[model samples]
Target: MIKLYGMTGSGNCWKPAVLMKQLGQPFEWTEINTLKGETRTPEFLALNANGRVPLLIVNGRKLAESNAMLCYLADGTDYFPADRWQRAKILEWMFFEQYSHEPYIATVRFWVHFMQKQEEWKDKIAEAMKKGHAALGVMEQQLQKTSFLAGARYSIADIALYAYTHVAHEGGYDLNAYPAINDWMKRLEAQPKFEKMTG
Candidate 1:
């Protein structure tokens, strides 16, 4: 059986869980509360020295990083195309998500929603939102052209970005400006077996 360690409501953790469910892959979930310092425990560190959630353990082999889990679970499936150029295109968005998108959007959401630092970190949050909007603009430009982030097909690239973009409002982002993104999100939600993230 595949056992996954993750925190509830976290976009990063939600990524693999949603993919596994859509792919009909059965897995066990073990919740680790990062806010409570659960990830710092020695036992958890043994599984992943980085001490992060969304750790996947299959057949006693452990894997860290949420995107890596997506790639591994989606392998040999349409979610990860067989075509070399298509695969590269999908990876391009995934990499952009991690570096350009998530760092700003996801982090701001974490600070505002989870930490409740909206008032305390107003200036910092404002600065981050600038970058977050820039990231969103970049996505808007691409999504305006393609039905999905990677291309016409729904792939893990969409899954990666959707995890955070859908809930960006909790971080003070106003998605009303991006009509294409709103439409794209609706399309993703309509996907078969799609489930919203839970806290």
Candidate 2:
């Protein structure tokens, strides 16, 4: 059986859970509370040197990194395209989500919602908001032209961005400003077997 170790509230962790459900893959989930320093423990470190949640253990092989796990799970499936260029395009958006979008958007969400350090991290939050909005603007532009990030079809690229983008309001981002993104989100939610984040 496949096993996942993660906090349900984390968007990164929630990514694979939603995908697994959508793909009809059965798995066991074990919650690890990072806020309580569970991830820093030696046992957790042995599974992931980076000491992060969203670790996937399959047949004794452990995989770290949510996006990497997504690629692994979605490979050869409709979520990952068969066409070389189309796959590359999906990867492009996935990479952008990690580098440009997650840093600011997810970070602020972590700070404001999880840590409740909005005042303590005011300066940092302000900076993240600016950069996060910029990332959203980029997404808005692409979403304006295409139904999905890679193209008309939904892919892991959409899943990657949707994980954080949907709950961006937790970080104080206003979705009302991005009509295309809102529409795309609605479209994604309308997908069959779609699951909401657990926490």
Model 2 TM-score is: 0.98
Residue by residue across 34-123, what tens digits does model 2's lDDT show? 999999999999999999989999999999999999999999999996899999999999999999999999999999999899999899
TM-score of each: 0.99, 0.98
Model 1 agreement with the true structure over 1-199: per-residue lDDT tens digits? 9999999989999999999999999999999999999998999999899999889999999999999899999999999988999999989988999999898999999999999999999999999999999999999999899999988999999999999999999898999999999999999999999998877
Query: Which ranges in model 1 have alpha carbons more than 4 Å from their true place?
Result: none
Q: How does model 2 fare in lDDT?
A: 0.93
Over 4 Å off in model 2, which ranges?
none
Each model's C-alpha lDDT? 0.94, 0.93
lDDT of 2 at 111: 91
Q: After superposition, how far is residue 146 of candidate 2 from its true place, in Å?
A: 0.5
